[model samples]
Every structure is written in structure tokens, then in C-alpha cells.
Target: MEMSREKVAVVTGANKGLGYEIVKALCRKTTASYLTARNEEKGRRRSRTARTRPQAEIPSAGHPPKVYQTDQTLIVNFFSLVDFCETISPLMRNGGCIVNVSSSSGHLSRIPSQRLRERLKDENLSLDELKVLMQGYLLAVKHSRDVEDGWGESPYVVSKVGVNAYTFILHRRLAPRDIRVNCVHPGYIRTDMTKGEGNVLPEQGADVVVQVALSDSRGQYVWHNGTPVPWCGDDPRIWIDGKV
Candidate 1:
């Protein structure tokens, strides 16, 4: 992509939280950003809301708004990401970049049962198969207040695992065309996802993602920052004796 020409980026779940911060960083450092949220009205409202607040009325005597708190937003979030990717596929210059903002929860070994783990290990899983797997997780979430209790207590964990799996899937399809497809664990950043518990900041996480998007064309999985954070042992090539 030309440095002078405007570049385009699509960030999912960007109304607030890390996603919003990523958009802010990208707008500051990169090119135009397509800020995506599950609810377009809500996203626009947030923009309006941010502007409407008086200087004196703001929290901490006028600092900034924070992450949105909601329990059942992921269903819409997944579909929003899909929509963004599909809509932008044709407009992408230099084959574009895709950053699936996953979590360390995706790498958890203690979440899934042995049978489910074995099932995920199979490389031949079809899109239909993956859908069924994901559906099972949604169902679990719907039926129980606690998703972990319902479906091994790893909905977020399993969703991210699926994300990592799909990253390689997209990479295989795009690498030949020189379209970069990669995944990153945002290092436990303090966002709604981490419930403000993580030590890392949103700006720090956004930097890592921006680095990968801007890196030279290399067909590899990476977590870009000061250095590449390797896949957490789930990758068979990197895994040795049951560790990454």
C-alpha cells in the first residue's frame, strides 16, 4: 500500500473498550478506520454521547468515557465482524489486513473437556462443523447464567480458540494471494473483556496490532509488538513435549 494514499482498517467491537482504543490509535497512526460495533445506532450514539457531555459534567471532572458493560453482546459482535470482513474484502488495497482481536483465554487448556479438545485438534474441521461447535457454545450461554458451567465454562475461551483456528484457516487461503491474516492475544489488556483487571493498557495492545498490520509481507502467525509473540503451543510446529 502507498504511504501517501489513505489506507482502510476495519476494527470489530469498536464502540468502546480495547476496540475503541484500537480505532483511536489507528486513526492517529495509520489511515482511515471503519469503526464497527454490533449496533450501528449505539455506536453513533456513543459518538454523540461523547460530544454532548459538557466539560464540567465529565467523570473525574471531565476525563473520558469508558467501556460499555453488557452481558449478551457477543452474538451480535460475531456477526458484525463477519459483515465488516465481507463488505471490505473487495475494497482492500495490497490485499488488506485482518486482525482478529482474541484473548489469552483462547489458549486456556483447563477449559475444554478431553473430548472437545480432541475434536478441536482435528485439522479437517469444515465450516459447517465449526458452526455447529460455535452454536453449541451459544446455546450453552443461552441456557445458563454461567456459560462455563453450561459448556465447560469456556465460551469466551472457546470462542477465542476458534478465532485462532480460523486465523490459520484465513491465512492459508490468503497467503498465496499475499493478503495477511493473523491473530493476536492482546496481552491481558485492561478493557471490558478483562473487566479492568489487567495491567496492560489499551494503547499498548493497539500498538501490537498496528505493528502486525504494517509489517512486511511474511506468511506466518504472529503477535506483533516489540517482538512477535508466538502462538501459545497450540501450533503443533512450535509445540514440543506438550508445551509451546
Candidate 2:
């Protein structure tokens, strides 16, 4: 494939499943597709195998932090996603797109606390503020009040919700650079992440990811199955406040 100056991409956890398919599609358009994961050997194998790979951290379960990796999930999923976007925005000028592969469970409505959701949308939400909010969840987990407190049983959903909220924040920050940002839930594909339990094929999930990656779409939590739905999984608060 011919490399292009205008388009280049990086995908974390792309070695298999939806992320791998994403790299495959992006390779057709981007000059270079950087595929990375925690397992370097596996990453290289996939990169050569696909012509790809994405991610860090263990999948979340509703358990307290008995070890280090579980707590690190919050850092990897939210902080890293934000930091990566901030760093890449300067380089991706003139209509570059960042697509954060997310999940439908990330929909803030899934989180029952109006107060917590509002904090996520805080106008001055800084990295520090975000950290505080997440740490609150950790405290809740420690005290065994996580479920009643509305973080739910899985930290995975909470982490993804953070991804969704920050996608909105980064869109506003990056708009001046003409770089659009968005997130997508790739429709529950059967992959290692899902332990091969999902209903969709990997390619089917990837087509949507490729679509958003190449488009001017921004601040959207959309999905691509047989039909595409834009502005999905939005918090009712956004609609209530008319803030997008």
C-alpha cells in the first residue's frame, strides 16, 4: 500500500478483534498504521499478520482492588485515552480524525447518579478533576458501596463513560485545529475481549470504526451495524441542557 502524508493512524489493542479490523481498514487510507498492545511479541505478530493490533489493562469485573492491575484499569482506559488525544492533536491538523473505540455500556444513562454525571460534564473539568471523580469510584469500591453509589458492578462501564465524556471535552479543545474526535461502540463482536460470546463478526464491527475514522464526525457516540445511528448513548443531561 502507498503511504500518504495526509493520513496516518495509531490503534491501541489492535492485535485482534475489532481493533485489528480497524487497522486493516485504516491501512488502506493512512500512510502508516501504528499497532500497539501490552504484549509486544503478540503485537508484532499481529502487525505482520494483518498487514495489525490495540490496548492495555485487564477487563474490569465488579471486584475491589486486591491487586494492582484492576486499579490501573481506570488509568489506562481514561487518562491514557485523554493524554493520547492531547498529544496527537498538534500533529493531526487539517481534518484529522480520532476515533476512540468505546462501548454502549458507556452511555451515561447507565450510570444512575445525576450528580456524578454532571461532574463529568463540568465546564472546567481538568485532568485533576477527572482524577478526583475516578478516585471517588475507587473509594466507593473499597467501602463496598459501589453499586448503591451508581458506579455499578463493573469498572469497565465507568471507564468507558469517562472515555465518552472526555471525547466531548477533547472535541471542543481540538476543534480549532480542524481535528474531529468521536467514539464508537463496535456492536459487541465476539473477540478475546468478549471471550468469543458476541453476535457480530469482526469485519462487521470494523466497518463503522473505519467510517468514523475517515469522516469529519465530531462529538458523537454513534454505532454502525447494518444501519448507522448518530449521537447515540448520549446522556439525557446533554439533551436537557442543549449542550450537545
Candidate 3:
């Protein structure tokens, strides 16, 4: 696999908050950057604020401009990731990396069912199987049985969990191509997603994500301060009081 002289990056949900910061951080190093957001206007405005030359400002199609809705969360957080990987991975030069922004809430301990946790932890889990799991979560939500079915009440949590799990599978598949993939819990930062209630600032969190994106680590779930957290193990309490 040959590496490219010019680096490129793409960030999703980058109109504001952590995503915006991530784009800013990447712009400092990458020769080209592309960002996508649910709100086209805000995305363009924020891109100007970042003062980075974005190659494209893609708008998420069919994604309602809402937060935390189960179906929408899955679409924005998980399925959109799938779409990006399939579309961009082939274009990425060797030695490039993909960072999936996840949250500590994605920890397997957040799931009530041990069986479901074990299934997600399977090293042999395929992309098709992962999609089935996501669909099952949606079905459970439709029936108002998510909690009883072992998934937690937060669609955000389930979506991030899916992101973490998918990171592992993607790393395995992309290894031969010399393209690294990792998921990051960018610390509980003061963002709209957190209702502005977090100890770390978005720029601080973005630094960590940028560090991981340029590192050689593959398929690991990392904390905002650059520590690796077990995606399948119990919660490491990294988010308590926004402590790194």
C-alpha cells in the first residue's frame, strides 16, 4: 500500500460542536477536508468560522433535523458511517485513517442484556449481522420494548455502541489496505448534544480525536485524553465529572 503526499479528511455532523472542532483540528493538518451536517446553512456558516477550505459541504439526505430520535440517531450515527466508509474508503490513500466519533455511553455495560453485549463483542461479527442488531433495536423501540429487550432508554447510547462495534469489524476488513480505523469518546464536552453541560471544551476534545486520527492505533476505543478504553468491558468511569 502506498501513501499519499496530500492528506484528506471528512467529518460528519460537523456544523457545530464537537464535529465542528474536529473539522478545525483536521484542517490544520489535512490538505483537504469535507464535512457533512444535517443543517446545510449552519454547516456552511460554521465552515467559515473554522476558516478552513472545505472541499464540500454535504447535507445529510432524509435525516430530519432532530436530536436523539431513535430512527434518526441510527441513521446519522451508524448508517451514515456505513455510507461514508463504503464511499470514501476506496478513495482513501494508504496510511489514511478513519475516526468514528463515539461516546462513553457506548460502553457495553450500558446495555442491560449480557447476551446482547456478548453478541456485539464477537470478533467474527459481520457487517450484515451488525445491521440486523441495529434493526432489532429499532423494532424494539417501535414496540416500546427497548428497555425490556435489554437496550437502554437512550437511542444515542445504542447508536454509539453500534459505532464502537462497527469500528472493530471495519478495522479487520481494512487492515490489508493499511487504512486504520478507531472510535473515540471525545470526552463529555460542552456541546449542544450535551445541552452545554460538560467540563471539557470542544477544542480540547477535538485535539484528542485528531491525535488518534494521526496515530497508528487500530480498532481501539480511546478516551478524550488518549487512553484506550475497552469497548466490550465494563465502564471505565472516564466520563464522571468530565475527568479524562
Candidate 4:
């Protein structure tokens, strides 16, 4: 693939871990890159180590509303992503790409209800419908009825699922403009978020993410090694010791 010096990329949560490595990797390919983090000082400190100068330091409102902590996960993982896409996509130049950093937990199989899975994967599923589904999930959580509703117990997992589902929705919306949008599972990486208990390194995970970000593939849920993983149905890859 040809690297473009004129291309610009932006990474969020880039103070440390996978997002930080993604910034470093993008610097090697794109001329301008920007990073956002909850902590201003840490984001500035990390940007100084990159090969290219950061275009800007974006400070994110790190904390969610004082509602249920589970709601916080949904806000950060799903809602914020939707907001970011809606806000930045129109400004992006044609042919620009958007890669949503997702997890294996985002796979459709993770949701127990086959009906719910089908609902999320429907091509006709609109952004408004997605919002309603997400709100329904939050309501389920509030009432301690998530599992019974087939949404599962882990808010993190459900949030990632939402991210993956929204990727397809956004991809369809942006296709006419030649803007490719996809999500990827960056493998289980040893990062601060995981308490350093993962098999893959942050740099290794970021490499796959950067690859997808610069590729022509659209509406794909890629595995860490650059393979496209099915969003629905059984994943053929064996899970050894809970690691893919």
C-alpha cells in the first residue's frame, strides 16, 4: 500500500496503551496525526515521542454522567463513538477512512438472544433504531434484567457489540461519499486497561489497527492479524485459554 503524507489521522484515548501505539504507527505513514486523552499532560507527554508532530491535543471529558457506572461504559464505548463519527465525518475529505477500535467481545455470538443478534445485524437498522436498542439495554441493566433480556452481564462486552453494530450503520451512510468505515478486534493486548494480563503487545495490536485504517476494506470486522472475522455465526478459530 502507498503511504500518503497528506493523509491525516486522529486517535482517541492515546495517552498510553493501544491508542498510544496507534498514534506512533500512524506517524510513520501519515503526515499529520492528532491524539485525544482524558489527561492533557499525559497526552502532550506521549505526543512528544511520536515520529510526526501532533497536530492538536484534544482533551476529552473522561468521566461519564453520575448515573450507573455500567452506563458509563456504554457512553464511552458506543455513544461517544457515534457522536465523534457524526461530528467529524462530514468534515473528513472524501476517501478518508474511519476505524472503530473494537474487541472480540463485540461479535454477534456474544449476545445470547438470536433475535437480538439478528436485530443488530439487519441492514435496515437505522441510527435511531440503534439508539433505542442501546437505551433498552441500559434499561435492562438498571432493572437487573440484562441477562434475562439476553443482553448479558458485562457492560463492556455489550458496549463493544454496540460499536461493531454501529460500524456497519456508519459504513452504509458514508459509502456514497467514498469514506470507508470498519471496526477491528485488536486482539487481547497487554495494556493498562487489561491490567497487563493479555497475550498480545500494544504495538502488535496497533499494527493491525493501523493496517485496517489505511486499507480499502469497508464494513469489515477484522481480526488482529488482518483477517476479516464474521460478525455473525460461529467463529471457526479455537479459543485457547480464553485467548483467540
Residue by residue across 1-244, what tens digits does model 4's lDDT show? 9755488888998877889889888887754889888789878988886643333333444655423767888899999999999999998988999999999889888888889998999999999999999999998887889899998778888899999999999999999999999999998888766666888988899999999988899989998878887899675245423334
Better of 3 and 4 by lDDT: 4
Return the TM-score for each candidate structure.
0.67, 0.80, 0.85, 0.88
For all candidates in order, the CA lDDT equals: 0.58, 0.73, 0.82, 0.85
Among these predictions, the greatest TM-score belongs to 4
> Please, what are the lDDT tens digits per residue for candidate 1 over residues 1-244?
5465567777776677666777777777757777766678867765454332212111333322211111233343343444555576566665667777766555535344656665654567654576577666665566663345434654455666666656665666666667787776666676654557777887788787777777663434454233444443454323422334
Against the true structure, candidate 3 reaches a TM-score of 0.85
Report the lDDT of model 4 for residue 97: 95
* 43-117 per-residue lDDT for model 2 (tens digits): 898888884233323464654553243377777888788777778777775677888887766777767777787
Residue 54, candidate 1: C-alpha displacement in angstroms = 14
Residue 147, model 2, lDDT: 84
| Position 107, candidate 2: lDDT | 76
